[model samples]
Target: HRFGITFHRNKRSKAAINTELETIPGIGEKTVIELLRHFRSVSKVKKASETALSEVIGPAKAKIIIKHYQQTTNEN
Candidate 1:
């Protein structure tokens, strides 16, 4: 006799995953999606210059994002 087993995986929104962007105070789902789309990854987003980030997310949010990363780096 032979037996087969199957496993099911749960589908989750890309923004709902364990994302550092979500941890930032002013960032939300829409912004996370936009950042991921433009920069392709969180690491790229973290490293992007204020001018580059502003191009994608505007000046206000770019500043918030940069500051968040800077503080996180210093804490580490």
Candidate 2:
């Protein structure tokens, strides 16, 4: 029973991990779409340098946006 509970929790955690970019602090569905259009994948976004991200996301939001994704990826 305890093992089953832990497995369920782990599955939920993994799902949450996969959606971190979709849930980024200032990013909404539209922005996520735009990001996908520009980068093709969350992995591409994550792999971008701050300067590259700024080019796509803009300077005002780039630092916060990149930092949010970086922190989430680092945490996981």
Candidate 3:
């Protein structure tokens, strides 16, 4: 059914997002869950301000995540 296909696609996308989050050093499963629960997607996470991210994962980790994404963005 079309609904089944849509569900599978959503699941796949969520997994891909999780995989990308996992690649960030010092971020583990718990932090990934927290990020996803709060931001819902990697795109949202990337756009989130440091204070916003700190609300979910604390200031120290938020800076690290922001720095990591900024570095990756600069490299590209």
The ten-residue window of minimal lDDT in model 3 covers 12-21
lDDT of 3 by residue, 1-76 (tens): 9999999999867656545778889988789888988898888999999999999999999998999999999999
Candidate 2: residue 75 Cα off by (Å) = 3.0
Q: lDDT: which candidate is best?
A: 3
- In order of listing, the candidates' clash counts read 0, 0, 0
Off by over 4 Å in 1: 1-12
Candidate 2: what lDDT? Answer: 0.74
Cα error, candidate 2, residue 20 (Å): 3.2
Model 2 worst lDDT run, 10 consecutive residues: 12-21
Better of 2 and 3 by lDDT: 3
User: Candidate 2: where is the Cα deviation over 4 Å?
Assistant: 1-19, 73-76
Q: Of the candidates numbered 2 and 3, which has the greater TM-score value? A: 3
Residues 1-76, model 2: lDDT tens digits: 9999999999757544434467667776666666667988888878878898778778766787878866777999
TM-score, one value per model: 0.79, 0.61, 0.75
What is the clash tally of candidate 2? 0
